[model samples]
Target: MARIKPQALLQQSKKKKGPARISVSTIILFSLIVVLAVFFLHSTYRYWSQRSRIQIEDKESVFKGDDSFLDSKKSDLPGYAVLETAKGSITVELFKDSSPEVVDQFLDLCQRGHFNGMLFRHVIKHYVIQAGDSDKLGAAEDWTSKGKNYNRLYTSLKHEAFMLGTSKTKHDNGAFEIFITTAPIPDLNEKLTVFGKIVKGEDIVQEIEEVDTDEHYRPKSSIAIRRVTLKQSI
Candidate 1:
């Protein structure tokens, strides 16, 4: 082998030193990448855990009504028969007489304040907003959670006059489902069930009809049902 010159020896040393210098930067870059990936994964997992997954088939199903959401002080309170929508304050006079089984079941849910702050998810302008559903709420530990989602069975009765419909009632009478009539809706004459009518607040209902609505019937503003109360007289 030929003897190395001074300049060649220096060049070899420089080459050796260059890799060591690059190694430190490469290690730092790899560590930073690993840290960022770990943080991203943790964030994703936390988001999924906190996200709500209401099943709508987990609430205590009592045909009468159950006071699960209320506190111990109001445990024995009875269910309400009247539903007061906050966006339109329309008073629905439930026809518990026609369909006692379904009405009683719904009344019990109303009394429990199940419909409170619930949105009228299905609002047809000049028609109706079917507003009872518990599955839409987020899964937050702070809020009153029903363990899982609970939905009622679908009623056998077809959509007759004065009747309403809801996606919430895939099973029985849903707690927060309602539909405000658009017009006579003559086509729904004997189809939808007219369980109740707006004793007052027709103007409010009209105003709600005028508000911007989405394809899913969701109102631009959250039209909430403050609470439903049962009354002997309208």
Candidate 2:
């Protein structure tokens, strides 16, 4: 049975087809280099932690003291609204000292306007812009129903911004909401209940903290507050 030789059976069929064609071209070039290195590290982690989309300017922020904060909230405790927003207007003063059932249900719903147009959905830039829990308040082309009612699922207070000294920290929600902040969120000292600031507009709260959010950050457009006056005594 010894006879093999047609050029040694074509050199043993080129040594078994040269390592199975170099092991199938080295597994297709190592699976295309591991899918291009996981798409370049997921596009550089979404270009530096994504979170941009701004253009909320019409600006506003005026305050001239009579001890502002809606005049220290109707002279040390009462009710007030004056919401007015598109990118301007803010006045929220209330204090049953720290929050008597969220300032008496937010002064019985801004005395009634319940927050005029309603739509501060939530901004979060320097950190904070939220408006009353949308019952539809402003940016009014025609959308009414600021019923402003609440039992406040939760919140004894502590959501304030700015340290104890004020850089900016107005709040409301005793009935719905009214958030406002810029710099100075000293861990919402004494636990959120700033009552007021933004005497005038605050460059419309940094142009609604340079808005442009969606993936649950909520705030694409619609920051209406159009009306909520009540400079009452303060």
Maximum-TM-score candidate? 1
Model 2 per-residue lDDT tens digits across residues 15-46: 87744345777888998999889888888777
Can you give the TM-score per candidate against the true fold? 0.47, 0.24
**Residue 195 shift from truth in candidate 2, angstroms:** 1.0
lDDT of 2 at 168: 28
- Model 2 RMSD vs true structure: 24.1
Best by lDDT: 2
Error of 1 at 216 (Å): 3.5
Model 2: runs farther than 4 Å from truth? 1-78, 82-93, 96-121, 124-128, 131-186, 190-193, 196-212, 215-218, 231-234
lDDT of each: 0.54, 0.54
Error of 1 at 75 (Å): 24
